[model samples]
Target: MTTKPDRFARWLPIAASLLLLAGCQAAKYRTLESFGIEKRDILGSRVEAARDAQDDAREQFSSALEQFRATVEFDGGDLEDLYDRLDREYTRSVDDAERVRDRIDSIRDVAEDLFDEWEDELDAYENANLRDRSAELLRDTRSRYGRMIVAMQRAEATMDPVLEAFEDQVLFLKHNLNARAIAALRSELDGIEDDTEALVEAMNASIAEADAFIQSLEGSS
Candidate 1:
């Protein structure tokens, strides 16, 4: 006898292939709907994932900043080894930033599909009163979504500056691995810290917006 988990495991790849063959965002959504999953559910899940990604990114950036500070303060040690460690931190930060971006893109795609479908279905209503109520609800939901996406984008924008700063410092150290380079980094440390602080603040605001949006979505369901 096949266990339920085993059955689900076997069915997962087939469902994924079907979604792939569906060929477009809207078509994929229809395929998912056939499996009893609604757009709102997918939107909520993606929002949660994006929020988690932002959280991970925040921690990773903070860790990278600390490593940078430590490297700049080095008095005597293997500078090459220090460069390698900082380079590793830079690489991890890049990966985390990419994950956040991918999650944001996924959220945007599902959100557009959900709103478009909702708007199109309004004309199918038989009762004017019901249609009016739904229309108002749709407007309100869109307004809240607008706020959430703006916050997410603002946070996303801040990430690039921080990453560039990290990359520049890492590259400079790779070439000029000496006490002079450490002194130069120390001078630039203030600017890096400022940028990172701004990033962390933006991500926190975005994460809060995500939480509020998810709660609103669930409450209405």
Candidate 2:
């Protein structure tokens, strides 16, 4: 049986790695600040990147769905080539989804650091009126950020189910590359289309939220 110490030991390297990564990120931000690029600017840029990534992912999923549809409707093409095309679409969709997730993570990392620094620096202000105004601004910014991130996370959560459905269709067609497999995939085509539609809608909402958040950050600056 694994003891508590064994569990702790197993996690130690992961914990240390996280600390090292955090230190590196802090150093990076400091370097950026020295060049007059603040965390708010970084956050806004990351949000823009994540929004763009989601947009790309939305288009990718739509394309992948189209490829799947084309595969089901194949009348007399190279069956092997059709399968290859579907596999390629699935691979591309996976890569796009990964990019979207990475961009969201980067946004979250920078936002947290920005908020923490903002909160800590609030203690250094000697002017009462300025401090109160700054605190109020921070609260408003945090509230808006909370909404934006929730929208982003909602969109992110919809991705996996759609990707899984796509993977299933691709793998099924791979194993049974013939007319019958194409027919089998026809039943799943509508389901994939529906899921992709939902994912796209969610991504659109998230992208809108990111745009608004970036605009707000710019307005405040």
Candidate 3:
């Protein structure tokens, strides 16, 4: 028969081994939590960046449309040429904006998945403490908002020159057309011009709102 002391000693080693394994499992869980947080941050950043690019493209598109309208108002060297150029530029801008939008959508999907995973992991923990991780995620989100502001500014800068050119073309067309012809075109042209102005104003307002939102996010971060 085995001695009682020997049996107890043998059981003690096995118990210690089990405790060590449990500790390791806990460490692994923490590691996964950290990974999830980082993933959320990175994906959020990508979505913001992509949105910024899309906004810039939108501004360009608006500017191009304004230019096209202005060109039509004025008689130019070759109306056909002007129309062709406008069509090409519009097509290019649309393609770029669509591409950026698609990217943003993809990033959003990834962000949602990351958030879900994070939530699931957090729920699994009884005493989950994620304050630092949350802060990191907020900071990353703010960075993305900042990028959007920069993009809007860039878009505005690009639009100024285009707008000026467009205005000049309109003025030229107005000067060259016969009085009766101008009168005939005025009604249609006025409507288009008004629409262009409204769109530009709306875009400006959107930029301002976006800037304010970004500022708020930065303050929070």
Candidate 4:
């Protein structure tokens, strides 16, 4: 009974341990799939949402500007109320822009994480002689779209001051160009109308440019 143990018998425990390790690794892979699902795929969606918000804010701002211009030019009865409404709308527009910017930033962060994850997955697949087939690569393509949204937001922020100044000028003109002043310098007031036209043209051009930029970003995404 104390005879030498068979060599095959001596190796049985080692073989069993190897099988157990392989099973553990397989279970780990299944867990990984579940973990991956918890992380939502929001890259494309976020970019699109941000773009829509930006466009809405811009359109509202433009409408308010138009209303302000018309009210000031014609001495509308509700001039003061219209101006107040326009100011409030502008404030809301700025707030909306900030929200859009924040959303773009969030999307950018998630896109970066997605890119890293894709790279890791690709490398693993390659090392294991597997084909790289993951939709995560789409994140790289859409990431630039997120960046474009951010750029537009920066441009919008830069233009905000210019717009405010323009609005203030309109208010000043409206206040100063009452019926008495208009009668006093009727000819000069008529000339001033040309300047107002030019100012409105400039503002419209800016709005168009911003809109175009936003549309381009949406198309790219």
Which candidate comes out best when scored by lDDT? 1
Give the best candidate by TM-score. Answer: 1
Of 1 and 4, which scores higher on lDDT?
A: 1
Ranking by lDDT: 1, 2, 3, 4
lDDT of 3 by residue, 29-99 (tens): 34434333244334434544555665666666666766565555655466556555655665566565556
lDDT of 4 at 191: 38
| Model 1 CA deviation exceeding 4 Å by range | 1-17
Q: Which digits, one per residue and each the tens of the lDDT, describe model 2 over residues 1-221?
A: 96433544465455545556555887766655554557786788788889999999999999998888888999997999999998999999999999999999999899999999999999999999999999999999999999999999999999998999988988887789889878977888778888998999999999999999988987887
Stretches of candidate 4 off by over 4 Å are 1-40, 76-78, 127-163, 166-221
Candidate 4 residue lDDT tens string, 74-187: 543554565566567556655765675676576566557755665666655644434333444345344544456456555445445535554554455457645443233334
Q: How would you encode candidate 1's per-residue C-alpha lDDT over 41-155 as one tens digit per residue? A: 7788789989999999999999999999999899898888988999999999999999999999999998998899899999999999999999998998999999999999999
Deviation (Å) of 4 in candidate 4:
63
Clashing pairs in 4: none
Q: What is the Cα-based TM-score of model 2?
A: 0.88
After superposing all C-alphas onto the true structure, candidate 1 shows an RMSD in angstroms of: 3.7
> All candidates: CA RMSD in angstroms?
3.7, 10.8, 17.3, 17.9
lDDT of 3 at 131: 51
Q: Candidates ranked by TM-score, best first? A: 1, 2, 4, 3
For model 4, give the RMSD to the true fold. Answer: 17.9
